[model samples]
Target: MQNMLLFFLFILFMDGVSGADETESVMEGDSVTLHTNLTEIQNDDTILWMFGPEDSVVSQITRKAGLTSFFVTDKERFRGRLRVDQKTGSLTIRNTRFRHSGKYKLTVSREQTTIKIFNVTVFGVVGEMDEVKSVSVMEGDPVTLQTDAEIHSDDLIVWRFGDKGILLAKIDVETKEISLNDDDERFRDRLQLNQTGSLIIKKTKTENAGFYELQIRGRESSQRFLLFVTGE
Candidate 1:
């Protein structure tokens, strides 16, 4: 009896793996919605959304006595970014990052657990033109890295410096918010992001002379700028 039960369980697991759906791609900083296709959730039903290969629970909805309550995991990467519809059990992830790319599984439970799988791919955004440009500036002069791409609400722009790729500033194009890395004091009060997703550094210094990289979400491309700072 023990050997027969093990074989049955193995068959069920293989069935679940074979039923997985095709892969879907979403640009970084955008949103992806997953649908359960159920018009109404029953009282005895439980719905769950899990991420990655580890199957970490991301969101859950439970219905009891006709009352539904939603719960999301305390995972740091998903904080304040997950939303679900109470009636449909659809899941929406907002402001997705590159690290969020992986397999997502949705489980529905009543008398038995039914599994549905989705593979999500998050693509990085780079510029459309030449990969790199050169900029020469003197101390105390402003320098701007220009890109002709239109900025969208769900897009994110990241600026990094040097070969080590130290983060300088990250801009959320939708919110028009700029978050400068506190660890890098060299750019304090000198960096600004324009409406066009261009980065403007107010005053250049010798220390700022290096290779800079700009990554824009949704474009799946990146641009590089080499800065040569001369003494004033």
Candidate 2:
């Protein structure tokens, strides 16, 4: 799955109608900017910056009726992390994480479409983080782990389970699609991911007690949930 996504973006980077590509490397938790090289943005120009395999919009600057607007995606990964240079339409990612390492495409639209592609790689390995929460639930009861935050219109949320980090469920904001346990039957129909990216385990059993991880694309960090199903 990961390779296929990389290939898809590779094609876009290689064979676009018009583009200037650049490579960037920054340490984790640092800031990096992708420049558009435009001296000034015209009132009729629309600048868009997208990231990741899904090409989700991370930031944008647009003008309509002489009204200029700057918009950044409110995704958890990008929360308080992305900034746009109003004058030049450059995009900056602050406090970068490894997940931020991906292809970024900038599209400037007016009479002609100008494209710029950036392949960003954030260095440094992330060690295993300490578990932040312990959840206890009774067998045969439903347990919900709440993320308690609203994501961007097109945020990608991935949920994994157990010590092996098994694929449990995913919420694709771009397509508004949800899939659960494609390769694991232990979850089967028992897993439910809510709109807010929370996980609901129905009829959870004692065996469900384990480690679970929530990965929000664009997130600088993830919250680990340690489930302890009781009354087995």
Candidate 1 lDDT for residue 124: 60
> Which pairs, if any, clash in model 2?
77-218, 77-219
| TM-score of every candidate | 0.48, 0.49
Tell me, by lDDT, which candidate is best. 2
lDDT to native, each model? 0.75, 0.76
**lDDT of model 1 at position 197:** 70
Model 1 Cα RMSD, Å?
Answer: 16.5
Residue-wise C-alpha lDDT for candidate 1, range 164-191, written one tens digit per residue? 7898888887787878765677778788
Candidate 1: pairs in clash: 124-220, 125-220, 125-221, 126-220, 126-221, 126-222
lDDT of 2 by residue, 113-215 (tens): 7777676766653453233455667779999988745688868999887546788888998788998884565676788888889999999865565667788
